[model samples]
Target: MLETEKEKVKKDAEALQLKMYINGEWKEASDQKTRDVINPATGAVIAEAPEGTAEDAQAAIAAAKATFESGVWSDLPATERAAYLLKIADKIDEKAEELTKLETMDNGKTLREAGYDVGDAAACFRYYAGMITQPDGHTYHVADPMQAMVVREPVGVCGLIVPWNYPLLMSVWKIAPALAAGNTIVFKPSEVTPVTPTKLLEIFEEVGLPAGVANMVMGAGPVVGNEIASHKDVDMVSFTGGTKTGKHIMKTAADTMKKVSLELGGKSPNIIFADSDFETAVDYALFGIYAGAGQVCSAGSRILVEESIYEKFLARFAERAKEIRVGDGSDSKTEMGPLVSQEHLDKVLSYIEIGKEEGARLLCGGERLISDGLDKGYFVAPTAFADTTQEMRIVQEEIFGPVVAIQPFKDEEEAIRLANDSDYGLAGAVFTVDGAKGLRVIKKLRAGITWINSYHPTYNEAPWGGYKQSGIGRSLGTFGLEEFQEVKQININLEVEPIGWFEK
Candidate 1:
């Protein structure tokens, strides 16, 4: 970018004044305090947002509860609600470029990746809008003079907390479904990446959503997040972030007996058999761990290869890993951008050192990339480790960076065994030309999301979540809409008489 253009963006960014959205109004922090939002790629303060406190969170929650009770949005006919949602989707597309730039600028993702997120977020809203029109209740046949039925109802106030990785997309994942299910929400985006998140509320306003139907409070998780999770008025909490934080939210939310849904960390495996198509397997293996700088929750961070082709796979993978262009996210030629923050970069580098100490061989690009003045930003080259053992920390833990652990297995049984051996059952993939074998492996893998001969392709039509400690519930498709709904079973007796035992 030219110096003049850069200065203009910075000046415009400084004017952001990230206000909170409550009761259909934009307001500042209760204390009138604000925090600077930085450009992760340049380490420049580009914008400022409210430094909300617990009190601010409480105000948002109270508004949502009262609005829900008023039935302003909850009582709307399904078709009308769908219309509101579709309008929001249309608004998102109209502002896609603006939203995409903010996402790339604030979160340090390549423009292409950020662009995809914008489109997907819009698609998410449309998907749920259509879903709201579908049948969501059932009736059952029973004995004469008696009737039974099951129906879906909104779960009242919902607290939605999204991670910084895909700020706009993740928030929309929870927001669209909650709105479709007729639930009010108090939403929180990652404090460090609040720019793109605030734009969604603007879209809500433009689309004429009802007051207090959706609110946003931005601040540290300890204060605002804890308030939302533990608030008695917030009926449920849906969080997507680290496992440790997810556990904390789950425990705190238990006090109010609030329903909790968490999409947590993962160390997913990508299994490639000897019979797999060689070039395709090698290409997707790189795409799996390196995309998003390997910060994805379901990132395929571990690669378990069949022994016969293991060496070839490692060679091709390392060759391609070194060639990935790492630089400013705005540069269209840059294939990968910096990590979201400096602190996260340090954590990922420390993991590389730990891998070395654990005796795992560094295959390629383990150090921070300091070329072309990239050292000013938090950039790390695509990294890989070979000969990793199942017990190694790098292999077992969720690195959440551009790091991959490549291990060789002797047979299909061992490959499946190694893949299933993890605390996270979030996602995994098997690449093989033999369709029957790939199907068998996919079935045997222990994870909520799995793929055959492909990696990192997700659909709004499919359920997304994990097993074991990864998460408690699913997101996307019909399941995503149901997450914010409570089921009720109604029974009626046609006859006016009661049982004889009651009379006695």
Candidate 2:
């Protein structure tokens, strides 16, 4: 039955065309070009998506712009807009199985992880739907004769670019709030893993999202992403990707002075103090960097251990890292799957070599793994490096792979310093039993999100983003809803009086 279910999912995904959705219609690229969507697990072509160009992006932008300006969606009451989002959430839940399979097949993560991501995507939409109806704006009274009010309104058409990792979940992080807040959207899923987002557009279509309200254009970053960022019609650009791309988007969007929110790269620290629950810290330390094959932007790739426990922890961690089961995504027993693509696999492997060249000791499992009858898939064993300095590239840079750099610190001050040493400050974790000490360490960490005694757990209700080069603005929570909105203030005069000082 398990094999049968797997076969069914594989069939369904292959049957899909993976086309773009623009102006309420499924369509191909303007030039009629297509690209193969490869399954990273097997290096097979699971489906084909449009190799969209700037012209295709223009169409999507125009659709979004026309829809927003039409006010068909934008003029609706917040509750009315929210109802549609709630339905999208429901639809997402209904199609969870199919979406999960496509996601796993496309991105090469375990099916279990993909399913969780699907559930999170649904929850994200629901969270925004409820938030949209809550009392927004504020009223203030200056005097008996004067009153003032401030209201939140949508920021016109928005452009959202999500990374290949966590494609659907990240897309929902931007799409849900943008839609619930009454803004139309032109969304670009990473060309590398466009399957689930393609599936999401199908759901949007089935749920009857208004024509031109939401659009999908799939292609390389240069063509699709660049057009969306620089397009005059798009009012805001929200991107989740590398810091370099985020910077490019920021600069491009600046031509029109558009609002830009970026959730970019990270080299976050996982600090394991000797005072913490030893076993729990060890487990999470592995989870933090190994989960998602460390493609996650908030991945705790830099681990700082107290000097006393450093050697002991390193030995245990390396031994456990070697035990991780890496195989095909379809295999129920597989703990980790392939990297997303051959290109990414090569990039990660190169980083491993660079880590060695930079003098970081490879404790274990730095090379690619090919086994279990899988030769073409991109698989890397979870790697741990010890005897690392703060200045080493492996410690400082954001290497988005299942490779972690372990360093030892003398005390609390040194740990804090090491954690804050990187240019990326997306997320960090502090493991300590003493509540006051944990809190103190958290306060000193420069990351946007800090976990105490845990790592890599995020809630839909909590804002997610980063500081420094880890990207700007926040996603999720009420703050996320506000990201797509513009605040407008109005003043009213209760008394019918004309100001003599004003020349009428």
Candidate 3:
């Protein structure tokens, strides 16, 4: 961008104020503090978000609690709630262009990637809208004169905290389901990318969603997010972020015994066998890690290849990795975009250095891009370190960047062992022409989402989460909607008469 373009963004930032939405009213923080939101693609300040504090977070939670207790939204008929969700979904579609641009500017993902996420966000609202209308309670058969049945109700206020990697998509993953289930919400979008989610709050208001049905407080996690988690009024917290932070939230939420659903980090593995369709395996290997700049929680950063095809596979993967176009996300021709922020780019670069120090082979690009209009942006080339061991930090830890740690396995058994050796069980994929082997291997792999010949195709109808450290509970499909609900058993007596064994 030219000097004038950068200056114009600064001017826009000065004019725009992303305020906090509470009780259907847009307001500033109590102290009137603000934080400049920088565009990672251009390293320019695009806008400013209200830097909310713990008091602000408390106010949001109180509003959610009050609204839930009032039953204005929670007690609405299922069809009514469903209609609101559908409306929000429709609004998202109507405003996809604006939201996508904000997402790209705030999160530094390609326009196409942001566009895909915007579509998925809309689908999430629609999915929950339809799912909520389905039968969820159960009728039971009992003995004697008693009739018993189970009914579901909303679980008061929900504390929704989402990550920056998928700014809008992740927010909808929690918001739509929480609303569909009739629970009021205290939402906290990541401080890094609060722009898109703030716009979502607008859509919620535009659709006439009741005040406090969905409230947003934007600030640092320790202040706003922790306040929501530890608040007694907040009944549940559905957080999607790093594993360490997930653990912290679990501990804090345990004080109030609030239900905690976490979708944490992963060092996912992508396996390629010699017998697999070679071209397809190579293509997905690139897509798995490079997509979202490898910032995905379920990103396949660990590529485990069979010994027979290790050398051939790594060469092709590295060749493709080097060619991924990295620049401003708004550029239609760019295939890859910069990291979300300068700090994150430094973290990814440090991981690359650690990979080299640990005696791994740098087969392709590993340097930060400082030329071709990318000098100001936080851009790094798609990097891969081959001949990695399981003990290496690059192999075990979640780098959350366009960096892959490639390792070779001797056989099928070793492949399975290598895949499941991580502390995370978020996602994994295996590529092989043998369908039976794919199933067999995938079954043994300890992850929540898996693919036979594919890489990244997640559905809203299916459960989305992981085992072990990946998360505590599921967050998509029926399971996701159920997370914000409570179950109650109601029994009625068919006959009022009773026989007494002892004389009165």
Candidate 4:
């Protein structure tokens, strides 16, 4: 067959065979039910995934527990653990194109973004693979003159729940570190976008990870996700999603007294000072929110521009926002794509309405676009609202769409106050020319990760989580590795000790 024919055949095959992986096996849903994975750009069905149930989640938990108890994964040498993660990374690299394409089809993100996500997923595995061999344990000097040491051991049977926005990357964020720390995992991918994870399981099997060491079950939060969070056999639960769902997971894990790590919602603020580099700040501010269709948890959705440059910034920002091309993710020229679902699209639209009602000026876009050929897609024009107040719903609530609200602040104090006024404080950004002012603002900003003149620049080596409702505990870096471990102290006697005077 010709190369074009082979390519067509591959795409066809990807659209057909959607399965769920549970207990290290790929199978159809027990009820044979399937959910249609829609292409948000065209509002068309891209694929079908098995609609998993609570029973599937229970089976996956059982499998993970049994695998952890078997000691194969735990007893494996750190080098061996690193080798397995490396193998998984290699498999991901080999299937990068397939995974990226699947993500674009299912998640309504641009091909460029999906491509980046695939690379990031691989890098996550590779990073954890390298970290597994690092020295872990601390040595302490005791005043009592006895040798004291503390060691970290794996907490068994972790439950990972990833959100739909960045399905593959988020899963890797949880899976790599948990496994690197010597814990087996039962992962539950979002039911709305489950194709990439199903393919990921095939890669795990191809890479020869032991059965049940890594498992995935697809279902909604109420069913599969809740079961994983509440399962008695699960030693820890790491979740990345909305704040409300994170709360539910925390509550459920509390029943079992399981360790929980959450990376939840954010209404992050991007404070652009008058003295900052206007062009750079504008660019970072736009990408921080509009990238990924603004579904990111750390998206700088709230824009706090200094009053001196408020008008100047809004004009340029709105112009740039209007230039963004909203189209199908498969198109290389498309800069933005539709929101994940019609419901989410409507929610965003309602927020726009609320913004208007709350008296924020709709400076650029306020409604869905109905271009000549774009009527069928769930496309919203990249929107900008000027004169937004901190009390406005658009400024306070997370729209989670390509919608930005710009509010003017009198000075640094007001900016910091407005920035920290939200219930969510996952991340924030400070843009200014003066390094001193930037540092001072960062010190006062109540956020987990604060970017100085930059936004959304994350690394595997940095610890990530929030101070308040954004999350509990951290992920990535050594902090993330510690999340999967429990500390134990061993005290040794260097010399014989005398009895107490009273006893004598």
Candidate 5:
């Protein structure tokens, strides 16, 4: 975050011009306008991508539609599609180190976290590759001469809008499954962070994915994203971002009656019981909200502890949070990095002020961090508040930053009540030594994914989604592949006996 660091990143930025990929080639925006890509850590311009317009988005959609209808890739054997996906996975693994560094520089996340994202992206591609080779439908026999079977088919061209939190990982969450289902893609990466997605397009080209089968267009939400949602040629839209934007996309895609899948915001809860392991619970509580500087959609931003241990746990948690390393993401020792942008940093700081106005007690870390040469970076200290009520905005809303609120509950019933009082139910966690108690609490929590004695540990094989306002559909497993497919029932007659059943 020093001047020299900014100069170094500026030099790197000058070497690359991130362009849009469409119709098997890289090009500029239709208007030839480009936007600077910033390194959040140093507040430096690291690269530039096209400020694509509606025309660019439409072009990508048209290319995908043509590829899907032409059957150049969609009609190929499932195993062959799997082969291409597997090769992409390998390529991702090959460039894992470089991609990690790029992600760190581009998104202001620690290099360690970026490495995990890269690894997860590769695993997601490989997971979908295996899924595509499995049987796809079910056969049914109806009494005498009737037979029927249901088969899954591609849902034509898909529009994918990914968020900036996990730039490459979120893209793979959609891209891997969409490709495995033999559907063409027109993807729009978050304009704030497009470097990794641009690199992903290079991998796609190197893997020999069929021409026009996949395209990447980078721009703001209203221009590129809305175009993808409302374009008539696009048959489906899969979006991951804030709840408001997801709702807008759903409404836009409704014009064409397109299939839609969404993964939105969360105000997740992490409830710790008196019977939980003290040390491990404390560690995971930190990991839940502090990792990625709490930009994750499923961050356990609200912590509920049993009244008996509330004071002790909160003290330890607050002390540890103050010690979290905040600096340039390229540093291996840095545990947390800057917020993704100046706007987001401001938003998080405003919420901290709101928390104080609501009379919530700030135990530690309520101000922006400007120390150890991190003055130029948009850094915020990991903040925690206690004596917060469910009605407080700090406890009820998705701060989406390194800010968390802790509340105490009287009993198990009250714990569940406090956890489910929010409008968002994306994910939650329970920390208890008793297995039966864990099951009881988890079954009652209204969340798509819940962890026992753990938090934020997701698997590639599991169905990832939320129950209520969190999302409309699932991703990351068999359920994810099904989202990109359409079901059709075929009927046949085995016996055609001449029995004057109908008057001819």
Candidate 6:
């Protein structure tokens, strides 16, 4: 690369770095406090973002309310709304490289994974764009022959809180549907990985969304996030994060009777039966537990294997775990990267200690990788444990890292029982060659989504949520769009007579 080209690239990266976006303008937080964004791969400060405060959050909510009241975004034709969303998608596509680089720099995810997430974000908006004008309602006949129609309307201003694990994808997951339903939005990107959304806001302007229709406020949970949840002007709050935080958002939203939707924590199960294709099941099991450094909310961190094949499976699984490359996310050869932050790394390490105290057998990779060449980053070796009992801490709690706990179940009934024993019911997978057995297992599973003979397969058109503590309300597909809307019924009578003398 030439010197001029290198300078241009540096300038481009700097231009994409952001402080905050309130209303229609990019500005610093009211506190003027800034936080350094670290490259998880190297533990070096790469950029700084304004640490937003409660005042900035209130301003964002006010902007959303003002935009809604002005009727600029609300009164636009649904087709025009859809067009704007598509344009946003186009803009994202244009800046894919920059967004992907920023995500990898901020979140410690591989460029490949970040690139794919950015693409998924674009696809989500495009999918919602087509759905914006398609919310047609149904009409029914009445015994009195009076006309009646049901209509779906936007649910006013929406407060979206995204998680750090999949920053861009989670943002799109909430933002796309809320906008599709004609709702203006005030969003708070997770402080740990705020870069992608800031880049997204830059694209929003180029795409020509009306002022205040879309906004971003960057800050921590207690400050900006709480304001979004409790603000009276914000009619709805959709959050994706930990269960503890999700509960707080739910409680705060209740103060104002605001609508709330949450996609919270999961201790999802991935069951591998004796009859499954051993090689395929092993790969699926690995990916389920280890991908994204196992930060995924729906990560299948618990592995339930048939007792008959448990020993053999453990050996192969451990062998594969050793082969997983742990290094900089920028390296194409690297299969896994560091966890998002040192705090998260320490938390996961604590859980590993608990697993040992509770007597679960540590199979392999329990310690952090402290090579002389790589000392600064927050890196943990991909970990796996076998002989894990249901009561073991590792088996029961969510170790959101490259950690997997294997428990051997005796039979189909026992497998189902163990899988549903957790407080979460987000996603699960059953690997079996027998078609009837796979279907039967899926039927008995308690999760909202079950994958048979496969794992982690999701679609933009499928409804996603949980059956129990995993979450309330669904996201993705047409069902996702409905979460940001309320239903209204309209009636017109062609011929009606006044019951009394007060007819006009």
TM-scores of the models, in the given order? 0.96, 0.96, 0.97, 0.94, 0.97, 0.95
Off by over 4 Å in 4: 1-14, 143-145, 493-504
Counted clashes in each candidate structure:
0, 0, 0, 0, 0, 0
Instruction: Evaluate residue 116 in candidate 2 and report its C-alpha lDDT on the 0 to 100 scale.
Output: 93
The models' CA-based lDDT, in order, is: 0.92, 0.90, 0.91, 0.87, 0.92, 0.87
**Which runs of model 2 end up more than 4 angstroms from their true locations?**
1-15, 502-504
lDDT of 4: 0.87
Residue 279 of model 4: what lDDT? 99
Per-residue accuracy of model 6 over 1-504 as CA lDDT, tens digit each: 112222334432643356688778998878566666777888876766777889999998899999998989887889999999899999889989988888898899998898999999999999999887675898878756478889888999999999889888889999999988889999998888888888888888887788899989988889999999988999999998888899888989999999999988889999889999999999999899888989988888999999999999999999999999988888887789899988898999999888888888899988888795457888999898888888787887777899989989999999999999998899999999999988898888889988987778678899888878888999999889889999999887767877577766
What digit string (tens of lDDT, one per residue) describes model 1 on residues 373-411? 887788999999999999999999999999999999999
**How big is the positional error of residue 202 in model 4, measured in Å on the Cα after superposition?**
1.1
Question: Candidate 2 residues 64-149, lDDT tens each?
Answer: 99899999999998888888888999999999999988889989999888999999999999898899888878999787788999
Tell me, what's the RMSD of every candidate? Answer: 3.5, 4.3, 3.1, 4.6, 3.2, 4.4
Candidate 6 residue runs with Cα over 4 Å from true position: 1-17, 501-504
Evaluation by TM-score, superior candidate among 4 and 5? 5
Tens digits of per-residue lDDT for model 5, 320-348: 99889889999999999999998899999
lDDT of 3 at 47: 76
TM-score of 3: 0.97
Candidate 1 has a TM-score of: 0.96
lDDT of 4 by residue, 1-504 (tens): 112222334343445557776666787767666666777777776676667788888888888889988988998999999998999999999999999988998898999999999998999999999988988788889966588999999999999999999988888889899999889998888877887877788888888888889988876789888889988998999999999999989998999999999999999999999999999999998999889888899998999999999999999999999888888888999998888888888999999899888888887877898795667777888888999887778988888998888999999899999999999889999999899999999999999999999999889899999978899999888898889998999998787777467864
